[model samples]
Target chain A: MKSVEDINEKIREGSVCVVTAEEMKEIVKELGAEKAAEEVDVVTTGTFGAMCSTGVFLNFGHSDPPIRMQRVWLNDVEAYTGIAAVDAYLGATQQSEKAEDYGGAHVIEELLKGEEVELKAISKGTDCYPAKEVRTVITLEDLNFAEMVNPRNAYQRYNAATNSSDRLLRTYMGTLLPNFGNVTFAGCGEISPLNNDPEFRTIGIGTKILLCGGKGYIVGHGTQHCPGYATLMVKGSLKSMDPEFLRAAYMPGYGVTMFVGIGIPIPVLDSKMAEKLAVRDEEIKTKILDFGVQRRDRPVVREVTYAELKSGRIEINGEEVRVSPLSSVYMARKIMEELKRRIERGEFLLTFPVERLTPGKALKPMKTAIKLVKSVMSEAIVISPETSVEIAAKIMIEKGVNHLPVVENGKLVGIVTSWDVAKAVAMGKTGKVGEIMTKRVIVTYPEEAVELAAKKMEENDISALPVVDKSMRVLGIVTSEDLSKLLAR
Target chain B: MFLRLRFDSKAVRKPVISAVTLKTSALINIIKAEVGPRRGELIVEVDDSIAEKVEKAFEELGVEVLRLKEKVERNERCVHCGACISICPVEAIVLQDGRVEFLDKCVLCGNCVKVCPVKALKLPTT
Candidate 1:
């Protein structure tokens, strides 16, 4: 296997052969991985997407009298100053208190673009560094140090988000249309940095790369990074960044986040590296999670490949749903081309990581003991109005369900219970369930609180209530027995 | 040409859109449609050469057909994050070089106007 030093020597000698991950895919497909490995030196992969974990550490060098700044505000957006006297960390997603559509991400982009930022700080006033308050304007050049240390960046892959519920859902994934009308997904899959090096084979601690149009390094594995699902903790000089590759984005209903452009060049040290570079959109898989469930563990509606996702439309439960690419494919491709140019021009060189990356622990969701009606309900058994009482009795016995919602077409028309069927059998009567079903049916919605649903059942002296949607279509049945089993736990 | 057919409360029940395709050779490509019991709207594309004929047919059926672009405005305030693109039903919105481009195929569905984070897309009330 070739060493990184050998690749660097070739880069310096202006003899390196570099291509983008997109081009390398064609190369590997045309002339197998073994042959491609001997020909290509590096495969540059890139992505530009909203990475909320991005932040900047700014050292507004000690104010005239050296006020030990306790709290900091940049463009009216709060920055954490708990670490030091004049240094603060401005997170990308923090919104401005005084301005609309402005955030820490905007402040960072404005600073890099050579624009001035209004900085204000208040201190509790320590004895030695004793100016209690400070207000000043600063540019990128004015800072003693400004380093962007994003705790998480370059996700290997992320699930495409959709909403299965009837109501529109506004999420960090973007606005998901109700009833699976559209799909919104993150970064470019096959050409993304972490996707090409899924195992962190070439990407590790100290590996040099592009960060928002500047040189950056992967410091370690990102928070919540798992083995197959890799993310990076990266850092780079904020002053060296370009605004073109770093942008401020605001998702409606979801606050501000930064669009970070990252390009990592994977040195083809072996045939294994070549094979990884050949990973196609068809081979990359991402879940279609229903964002309608506002929880850490949203339900996975389906597993689809980037091939299907990028095709502009995908089938969700037999309906063709249009997919939107939230991450800029155009920008991602531009970054890949830019990185390739730098490598070919010998301006950039590959570096071996001093330490290998280790997966961070899996995420632990916030502990919420509260439950909804849906959490305690079972799938409702429904029969049409024309069903005979004899068959309804057989269904109740075979399915072990006491209550059934009588449906006409797709709508909930009436309710029938095991008692009605049994009573019909005892009376020696044979007729359709329509004659026995209750016309005025009580119903509960999916999002209704379990306590409220239970109270409705108790007050009405009913064992179960049919769950329906806005259109009165039967969703399921919530039974008092189900609540008893759940609350007993 | 793309045309939007709006059916008021009284016209909502009539099988007008289906009637257009059933009676004519001009097959409609319905890009976006939202029909309810009270009111309904449809955005469809037919042969540009026969666009006038189709619009006339819809009007004859008492449907309000609009060739509207001024109804919604994409102002200078847009951050071009393309969040509006995700919710746009007719694939009318696109992002090019960090700018949101509204294509001619827009049905004026107002979904993008509702979803713009910076309030860049706006629909002027009649």
Candidate 2:
């Protein structure tokens, strides 16, 4: 395993990122044709199924030519049919004796415009009109070198099956999805309440995510399941999608699609219970088996701005609400609606104002609090400065903790919480904490009154405060526990 | 999709030989187009000396090669466990046991063959 220091060093070195599709294309170009071909292991002949299956083959080194292809086969086809293409490609490979052989009328030079291509007829009618053969142009996507199994059949099936919705769905059915109740989102919205929660350090920015929901939420992460509403949001580059359009495109037969992200979890007896329920029947087998590992105990209901619900900006009967760092789901929804309406109307600032709390003039000093300064504090959650808000949410769930103290130069500078983590997660930031952590942290002097600390806690809605000295070193944490002890005495 | 290859006997070397022993392995030149320069061709020559040893190795590794032809009457032999699944940096494995059972996601660096437990999974012989 890479140590915290090593990971930090890599982060400091910074990464060369391709910011846009144009940039990514340019990088491929820079790699040059021969390198590109060398990098290109397999080509999929343009189908979502083919692309994904070829992706799997490329992933596993099972595909002989080592590259699945797409696009060059598309010709003038505006949109390539994702799944059907995969099936045709599979047919070609399975029946062939030559491992790297490529022969198929399946590669359609003409795109299926209004009708599905008659694959069977095409296969039978071998040679007729020949302009150019449809071949999926091959390109190599860089690898993360991460240990991920070829996704279960269901993963590709469902992701491909869903069409126009902006919200991508990843499910863990049967034993394929691990037994963890953590999910990370990358780059999307800006929600603040998520910024103050305890589980805030683990999320990263702009990275692939694994969401663990269901049983893992309740059991592993100690959270109370409140009846929170969930509203799915789908945003595309163009405003061409609507609820009905999405419904038609994605959720055709299924009443609704439940998408959750998670991580590896500690196995428990409840998983056995889920297994029993799954084995009893076939249809719900996936659900039962999935429940064994899913951490849904902690309910993270999706919430949208109230204005969207009222004005029908985004329609669906789920619920309309706002989520605030301090406000409960009920109040937060109303506030969020009004706030979002203001934002849409250009009445609000894009970012929240930063507030640094300290001792006020009227506050009294502590009886025996001494400001002994220390250079550093142990027992802290160290995260990269660039980790995004969404990834922080995942980190919280995976680490089974809520608070991640942001450190710089081996000294605590800022702090992040579960709420902040969630907000960052929802916003889809995959950057480090330095980018999201509260740069302006509230520090209480040792000479500050207990009442002042109490007020700070209440005003900031924080559970603890780092008592610091003049040198900006953390002396001690004046926590809720300490306050409670004082009250008892 | 989830079957492990095991030998009939516990001997290690014989099973290893039997596992790679294709009924009629393709010639090296044909395989070269696919495997490229880094790796050499694969040819299935019936060497009785290695067959028993191959089977023994497979058995020793606790692999049970699923005999689809004999048991299920299907000629298909390999299942896509992605011996190289965890190792690949780029997410190449797009589909398995689905449409396009194998993908060109491979780097063709011969890592999968090295990791193949049964030695049956390999690049086509040149």
Candidate 3:
């Protein structure tokens, strides 16, 4: 077995042999691990996907009148400025106040691409720094320092996401079609760095890596890292990185996020390392999760290998589902190749981890969620506007439902209650139910807090509210009965 | 070629797709389907050589045939991450030689268009 120092000496002398994670599989299969380890010095692995827990730290040069900024916004996207004067950390997912589809990720990409950005900051004005506000444009070259510090990235494996419910699910995993219609997953499987080194034999703090096409280092075990499942906290010089490797993704229904390109080079110190590098797509498995459930602990439908997922088909609960990749295996392969070329050309070298990554607690979610209209609402029974009062009354009695939303062409037009039917019968009115139905119906969205629905019902003296979407399509019905049941609990 | 067939209640019960495929000797691979007694929608792919023949045969069978030739216009914003590869119901996108390649098998399902984070892909109706 060779050492990292020996591999570094070979790299310096331009005598090192490097292969990408993709090519290592074939070489090891032909030569076997023992021979392949002696032939290759490093194996480059990479992955690219939408990583939300990432951001940048920027040091805007001090202005003429120094100010300790209290608030900061880059292109109308707020940046955290609680650290120091002219310093801020802009998260990748923060949305822009000025517009939709624009966010901190876009701002970061613009800077990396050498474009000027509008910077506005406000301060309370201290004696040492008297300026209360500053507004100006700055490019990447103008910043004192620009470093990308991603707290969590390069997940070892991510569960594939699918939806089993009858409605479209727009999530960070992309759009999951209703009724297990499609599957979207991340991780490049065999070529992914963490998958290659599952036990962190060479990955940990101070491990040199390529971040956005620039040299970077792993800082520590990323937040939420637990046993067997590894992640990374890495930092790189943002100013030196190439914009081609970093991109901002404006996911429809979800906010903006960044596609981070990360490449890790593992020194083939022995046959054991070579065997690990030879792991195939079929060997790496990730769970399939149902994103339809709007809870922290979404139920796992099944386990699938990346090979099965990449084949565009997988069986879920006795049904075959169409599969897709949320992570770009193509881009990940590109990064691996690029890193391999750099290593072979002596421009890049491998480094041993100064400290190994250790297991930690899993991610902790909020203990309680404020009950929403959706939580208590029941399925809505709908009726056409032309239904006769006699039929409406008969239907209410047969169905035992108090309220029925009067719909015309799939839109909520009016609401008819059992009380309306009683009044209609008492008044001996034989006209259509539309005439007696409440036209100015009170409504609440499914996402709205239950308390708001309660207040609306109490103030308006209405016992129920129809839950509708933005386009007035009826979803469900929430009533005093449901709220009272919840309150009793 | 990728095609979407709409069958009215009258035609849905007749097994139109089977008859058309038998007539043209072309196997039809369905991507997604939604059907009831009233109406039905089917997205399918056929061999490029037999695409026009299959379309005509389906239309003759009282099925509304729409040629899904609409393309995904990939701009410079695309990172070629292959996220769109898996989301394409028709498997029109694939990675070849470390690059994302778009094939003629696209059905214009639009899942990739919605899933793209950078909005690099757009399906402009032709």
lDDT of the candidates, in the order given? 0.85, 0.28, 0.87
Q: What does candidate 3's lDDT look like per residue over A174-260, in tens digits?
A: 878899988888877888899898778899889999999999999998877876567899999997798878898887788899999
DockQ for all models, in order?
0.36, 0.01, 0.43
Highest lDDT against the true fold, candidate = 3
Error of 3 at A342 (Å): 1.8
Ranking by TM-score: 3, 1, 2
Reproduced native contacts, each prediction: 0.32, 0.00, 0.71
**Which of the two, 2 or 3, has more DockQ?**
3
Candidate 3 clashing pairs?
A249-B117, A250-B117, A324-B86, A328-B81
Interface RMSD of 3: 2.2
lDDT head-to-head 1 vs 2, winner:
1
> Residue-wise lDDT of candidate 1 within A1-489, one digit each (tens)?
888999999999999999999999999999999999999999999998889999999998877788988888998999998897888999999999976568998899899989999988998788888888999999999999999999999988898899987667788888888888789888788998888987777799999999888899999999879865789999999987878888877777778888899999999999998998999999989899988765567899999998887776799889888877777677788888998899889888889988888755667777877688888789999999999998998999999999999999899999889988888888886799999898888888898778878877997899999999989999899998899998688
Candidate 2 residue lDDT tens string, A216-281: 111111112111111111111111111111100011111111111221111011222112111110
Provide the lowest-lDDT 10-residue window in model 3 chain A: A359-368
Best by TM-score: 3
